[model samples]
Target chain A: MGSGSGVSCAVTLNTSLTPEQRALYQDVGQINHLLDSARTIALVGLSSDRQKASFFVAGYLKDEGYRIVPVNPKADIILGEKVYPDVASIPFPVDIVDIFRPAQEIDGIVDQAIARKEKGIDSPAIWMQLRLVNLAAAERSLAAGLTTIVDKCVKMEHGRYRGGLHFAGMNTEIISARKRKR
Target chain B: MTHRPGPRKFGFETRMVHAGHVPDAHTGSRAVPIHLTTSYVFDSPEYAAQLFELKQYGNIYTRISNPTTAVLEERLASLEGATGALVVSSGMAAQFVALMTLLSPGDEVVASSHLYGGTVTQLKQTLLKLSIKVTLVDPHNDAAWEQAITKKTRALYGETIGNPRGSVLDLEKLSRLANVHKIPLIVDNTFATPYLCRPIEWGATIVLHSATKFIGGHGSAIAGVILDSGNFDFSRFPAIAAPSPSYHNLRFFDTFGHYGFLMKARAETVRDVGACVSPMNSFLILQGLETLSLRMDRHVGNAQQIARYLEQHEQVAWVSYAGLPSHADHALAQKYLPKGPGAVFSFGLKGEGAEVREDGKKFIESLQLFSHLANVGDVRSLVIHPASTTHQQLTEEELAACGVGPEMIRLSIGLENVEDLLWDLDQAFHALSRSIRA
Candidate 1:
């Protein structure tokens, strides 16, 4: 984000976003359902770096009692889990194929997750991360009976499901009873 | 580190005014109060013990932390997008504290040759006595940095904009080199300030300022601040990661997480060195910070006009402002400091040899508006001729290497109307030309 210039993309922020795009961006039910039930997740495009958003999210989820399988051909390991080259190469069944790729790259990742389900693998849920949206890919997965989530981070959903998502100054209580009565 | 939003989330101007402060809680005071007191009251002995032991966070001594200084620290830390900050008495002291915390005997630092004269002395002379070796390299020459590094090389140091002359730094290249060498990049951001550039955004692990300068904006107080990016992994650097014999064998990195270096500097160095700022100075600097964007805007705007005026003047040989298209670092300036090349810049006189040095002195003496001074970043214009003043003893050849010619004059442009400043220079040049002909 600080690479090209130290300023935000103020103009590119879509104030006139289409209705469907806005709804897809704000869809918390599908995200909550996918996050609440998924025990094991395959993190697509996971970086080895601990500072990157993808790696930090994966680490947080892992600490929250979720098993994570990092999928990246660039490395052999991430967060101590053996990284698979592709989702189809995961030796065990994955309940969720969580994506951390950009918008254009989402179709290619969804194609892999859809192929896994057709070959007698567990009909996995598809989760696309923040700023990643493909309405066409999401529709195809929905038509194939695979639960689909777009433009939402799976870890943030789990955090919200447990109560609130805290980024910047925005807080959603992600915990139920962490606070005590005096 | 306390869940503050990134500077990217707020516009630069918005962050300037509201980054590290909020309205007063009890009195609902809109102004940041000057917290004047020597010590903070603790609720109980247990609370005092916890604060002392670093088990809990609260202020005990004004020397280590104060409410007024905390606002300034947070304001600057937010502006620079740093995880934490430690405000000190002066820019030199900030440099001393950061280096002291990071270096032990036998450690080494690879620094840029283009630095303030005082910094050159700090590295080349005083710091060597502590057994830390510093090898100065030309920052523009990447290979010189590589050649200077040894197994003991602990860090790399440079300024956001080089001193005396405003030579912009190639932040991307320098940062990549530091990362590859497994070292942190420390940047002295006194000249640029966060208003013009945030060094942390360009991978500077530590960013510091002579808050006495532009951060104070009025030359009202002497202060400095050290900002930690909290991005560097200290676990690989043994100085910070290793267990401390004085602190119950506790390792700072293991205990403080991302803020280990600053925690160590605050707990050990600031506590020991005792160069912390007074609450009164902190309040004054905060007032300076609140208007930094407005002041810097005019400062840059006025500097641009004066630099162009001097460039075309008959008596001027060369101008060294990064904003000028003719400068050697023009492209680097556009990349790193797009908000304008800042207020302070230098230019050289036209004559050669002994006559050149004489005209430089005459020009300075003839200026009616610009005050001859030892400082920069003042509300009023300032002029200094190094050949006749600061570097008077150095020969022409020696002065050239340090970005100064015997005929060079440095200017710190102020917020006054441009016409007045240009008129003052014109009359000075008239006096200079008459003396030259006679």
Candidate 2:
């Protein structure tokens, strides 16, 4: 699962000593690298709610230099970006199609991604937020030469990679350990 | 406390009432009295050794097991169609022990993306720290599950019906995938009590219940149970079968035979981690389980009636309950839960109009009968504005990923008279109308 680049190779070795560990590290590392490289992410279901993870994570990623496109039917604008009703109507090349819909609706999203590719839009990477993976669609994206990251949180990943621990405002290590102790 | 004739074998409901209890043998009291005592007296060193060495299954300490709690465990195990059960302090503890026994650091768990918010947090945040990676996939799409599994994958997890949104999972497909991969399928059957849908019959290897919900039939208890079907072959999972530095070189599969996973979880995970359910809570949950079948029947009926009522309401924008034919997963629900979809659901208000606040918080505040709270699985209807509450911690993008909108109100339907419930909703809607007009 390691990328051809030496950076992933080094991180893979340093973090994961076992073969299984190496695969997981490499898979997540490659996805993060892709996220870092991509300039624009079209977030399907990006809400206008300030308290939402989508709102905060998009805000954070926008600060990190990626353009955030809010694709919600309800909002006129989110994070200063005009909200598009769907991916098909976004009217721009989308580098990544980050979905916030349920797993059951992912097949439709994959179809939209493929349609975008057919229309000469760059076959964007497909990233499902935590607890939001569509395996069939993920495979279709993979077959179409698009990258896929599923069942992982974009906010948590940003925190993991950008050295921003405690993004959720709770100390993970101490809290979980104390929880285990109790 | 010597094994004691295995608590008078009886039918499931009867045992639920009386098992692990014997009229307080000393006190001659009929009820299964709560033994709040933390420590127990040892008959002798030889007897203690026999208990520790698995020579006998008796109460050595409260942390391991208790008489009052054992009845709940036995009853739940019987009801869930499993050989044995472990009652933990909380639903999270049950999940933690189940995963810890099945997975080691660096192993993987393939789970549905549709899960409770706490579980999603646990898998993505807490479990990630332990180096046990989780792969989220659409459990409805069997291929996605198959693709997510690598050699390192250990288990598959899903809720019978998703929390908040009430999307039904394709348990049969997930179970088949787990079998093909030689991994156990663990179904969190909290939303659908055993009376509604039993995952064991559908190929789930283990079942977990947040007894705080329907199992308790009341909101008083916060406990969880893990039921081992004793179906999945642990010999297939070498990591679990092999000796560990954690325990005194005791291979769980070799020592516990069919109940290896449950035994290891009790001895290693529960003993070391110490998340034992209180005897009092166990007693409370047992009382609830007695009326589980009856309560769930009413819960399903009330939820169906309310979902229909909400669907027809003028003020509601969208209703996402599987019982509603318009729900995207309605067909899947028909397949997995033919009887009826469980009680929880989500609906969005008409927040786009100029009269309504763009955030949709007003509609939630307008609800009268629905208590606004962070918890779910209550006998009384519950409501929350996700953008403001349950998922407030999530980013805007994350909230969308979870299908939660600022204007969305998640409702956990309770077992109230449908007519009265609707009257309350009518008044709430009328209030919203007044507020909008004003």
Candidate 3:
């Protein structure tokens, strides 16, 4: 029988992510920091349908006090906010540009975010929704000194860190035997 | 270890100790700290609104969710391989919330006849007040269970190991039956904790535990937990699938998907009814959960010895422990509870009618080391005459239905040395024999 002190491995226990992958994706402390400091989020591909994941996430982020800048070409307005056609078209600065678009469209989005960063229109960090990842696009974003997070849900990370995910009992991937103190 | 890309699964013991919590991020403390506040501070009015609307996850009031209790919920969910878990004030509260959440007026439930006495009353009597009907059927009889279901039947309920009766549920057979009928199977796993069986793995959509029992093995706290497997498609269940007027016509199933049932159970039922668990009780249960596997091992070992001893004893009529090969459910127990059929079991005292009742009481009163009490699953050995104590509320017919006869004496074998427990039982039986002669 093994001791209950927890596994000695240096990787996260909940998921089978490798050490390097864990540092990249499962460093929830970093995600928590990002969620804490970032304010406005430009939600690319925010859908008008209430059933869509993007719409739910956008609405959730808006409720969490983050200003949601909807970036969808199909709609003039979504979630009660005026929608931008693209990242470059958005006039005001956004702290994070969360993508809900397909993986094939990520390279173009990253290029636009880089152009906006150079022009000082927006130096927004890039976040891809769960199951939408583009390694090449992430590399380009990182090269432009933009923090690039892939395949993670921004609303989920916010809920996980703020102590809300337990309300419905979703595994937050945080493994520890000790409790948190206020 | 080979590198993997998805979430790494921890062993059961590892999960029991660390699955739900991380160290105090601010204080660097390695132990679970009790957050005793009645509520939490929100970032703003908007944030509070988000919490109330269920758009965001965070604490608002202790009556709804507490950080300390959340840890317990998470740890138990992890151990049970469930998608999520909710903790309530007591074992009965867990059963009530789960049933009330799923069943509406006119809906029906088919449950095991072999169950804790209070549960039978709650199902047969109290739920009738809501117009929700329940049919009691033999747990091992699949055909009876099938015949009991009708168009009104929404959920099938049974214990993994029947309380006091010690009959093991055929989880797979019932789950299959539930699936064929497009209903959910809810199981009470108080007797077989995750260490022995995970009902969810066998297709139970919802699993319940009286944490007041083995999960809080030391009997230091009273609590209950309900876990959702997140495997059931509730798109047809009206309570979950249909829009609710209570929350602006929000459809829990359409919105939360896999987590719909639990989210409704917490946000709607638990929020309104207010049978929430105390953070102190949750903390005490967490302490018990840490050593659960180790304690269960010794508990089973002691129980197995006692069951065998009682089976051959001159004063003992029959032992109903599934761990004993003579038990009617012994084969089923081996399939579901290979480790052992838990620490609690019942044995009948030798005699008939009034004489047997006297023997049962005398035997309990004469026990020197074992504490005679109504509760079970404690570190210290406990004994109870269910006909006179726990099951006293039931009529003679109901008593026989749940297998609690007047001669039945229940023993919750604990973590004491086997020889000492055997000695305690021997002395008690000897004292009972002398009293009968006198």
Candidate 4:
């Protein structure tokens, strides 16, 4: 198995998780694969306010050499990237659609993602930000053969595997005894 | 054949080697690079403002964080099972920064009487200058510890294995006391080095290490680290939960959650104190950490043999190593430090007052292999007379309280061959006897 981020995906799961939950939310290997494979990410609900988590994560992703498309109806540009009102409106191919909207709003956004795929646009993976889980919509996206992530922070995952989150005293949960491979 | 999922938790040995670093993305260098630069470039004016305002996490200057030092912090944190760690200039700086961040002028601390001489001075003398009073108590007296906790008391402090005398602390009991009193239990785990024991696993909220010791394995680097378990609820603790005018009313606990204390220590305390560890020292310490377990196993094995040999000698009055069955804290040692209570300990010589002190000096000088030095945790064995050197600043009563006596000769066992070390000790004992006869 290839871990493009150089972080081991082996993880102990909480006993409370079901088989479906294990394959979906807890597959760190898949998360690593997506992070490594995706080059262009479209961040839905990207805010113009600097203090917002969405804005902070978008800026971090942009800095890490990822092409970020800001999808906000209110903004023209964010973090020096052009803003599109929705995922479908973006002219270029998008590998991931990261949603920072509320839990209730995930279905509408997933609908837009599905419509884009049906129209022969790129089959973009759906990512719901931290604490924004929509299992029903996630199931629909999964049925349409699109990778889906829920209730996770994209920036934190990126930082966790790439050896960045520990700087602020956060636990990265990576335990290996060998020096990181070259 | 059924597919089996690999074990989720990596072993300690594996983590020691690999936990804190990844290959350099640009150059593919497997080893940790010494980032010798003082400052990092900002992408834009707006980005610079965000970093300065603590709205984002990125390198601003080496004083706060360096790529090399960050690996040391993360690696140590991984070993200790702590949420995060901060590296400082020296062991004293780690303790000072931790206390300064956790306390105000009127706050108080309850610490163990059994501690390194330098730590005792920092607690009793220096902290007093800041109006923070520290009351030393018998670590064995559970009642004394609880009685010392007043409303003004902010932390309970102790060492995992006490210096010189080798008294093992009852971390679980003290942690429970701290929990009831709503204070944090801060432990100096310099002696145990997370290989033998992790104070955080028992209940400590914070752990401090003089990485100058076993963490470095070799005596090449002088550095320290402070680790936070992130288990303490700082919601009511004003030092962390309250807003700070220094950073335009930023509340650490509210802003960073579990990472609040260390982030404040690094951004505010270390930034102002300028007590930052250099990237070169970090690289050296990292090299030492790679072979920490290997060195410690030999150190412990050699120490057990030496302590046993010393106990049976006719000129030796008593041995204070917790690994010995006759030791007072031997049971506690088994509980806290199952891999033996470290290699450094103290022993008394057979004689009365003035004669015994003379014998100690003679014995240390006669040893061919053991170097006479003040520092411990070196790869080479070291000997010191505590009453005349390390603990000489303390008065008689203070010296008695700390279990240091005129006849006390402290030994920091090294990774030398046990047979060679025993032969050296045998010759030193004979030399002392011959001197007394003359």
> On residues B1-438, what C-alpha lDDT tens digit does candidate 3 reach at each position?
998655455688888888777765467667778989898899889778767877767788998888889889988988888878999999999999999899899999999999998998999999999999999997877789989999999999999999888999999999999999999999999998999999988999999999999999988899999999878989989999988888777788866766789889998999898999999999999999999999999999999999999999998889999999899999999999999999999999878998899888888888988998889999999999999888888888888888988899998988888899899999998998788779
The model with the greater lDDT, 1 or 4, is 4
Q: Tell me each candidate's RMSD, in Å, in order.
A: 10.7, 26.3, 5.4, 4.6
Q: Which candidate is the best by DockQ?
A: 3
| Ranking of all predicted structures according to DockQ, beginning with the best and ending with the worst | 3, 4, 1, 2
Report fnat in order of the candidates.
0.01, 0.00, 0.48, 0.29
Instruction: For all candidates, state DockQ relative to the true structure.
Output: 0.04, 0.01, 0.29, 0.25
lDDT (10s digit) by residue, model 1, range B1-438: 587432234566676776545443345455677889999898778667645755444578888888678777767876787766889999999999999999998899999877776777788678999998998887788889999989999999999888778888888888998999989999999888898888888988999889988888788899989988877889878878988776666677755556678878888888899998998998898888888889889999999999999999987899999999999999999999999888888999987888787777788889999999877888799999765665554445445656777777899999899999999999999998788778
Q: Candidate 1 at A148: error in angstroms?
A: 21
* Candidate 3 structure lDDT: 0.85
Question: What's the distance in Å from true for residue A39, model 4?
Answer: 8.8
lDDT of 4 at B281: 97
In terms of lDDT, the best-performing candidate is 4
lDDT of 4 by residue, B171-263 (tens): 999999999999999999999899999999899999999999999978889999999988788889999888877877777775555677988
lDDT by residue (tens digit), candidate 2, B1-438: 675331122344453443333332235556556778786787778557645743334577778878677667756765666756889999988898889878788899988877777787888789999999998776567778888999899899999998667888888878888888888999999988877788988989989988888889678989998888766788767756887567656566644445567778887789998999998998888778877767777888998898899899888888999988999889988887787888888887876533343435665666677888877778898887666666666656555556666667788888877898889888888877777678
Q: Going through the candidates in order, what is the number of backbone clashes in each?
A: 6, 16, 9, 7
When 1 and 3 are scored with lDDT, the better candidate is 3
Note the chain A TM-score of all models in turn. Answer: 0.77, 0.76, 0.86, 0.88
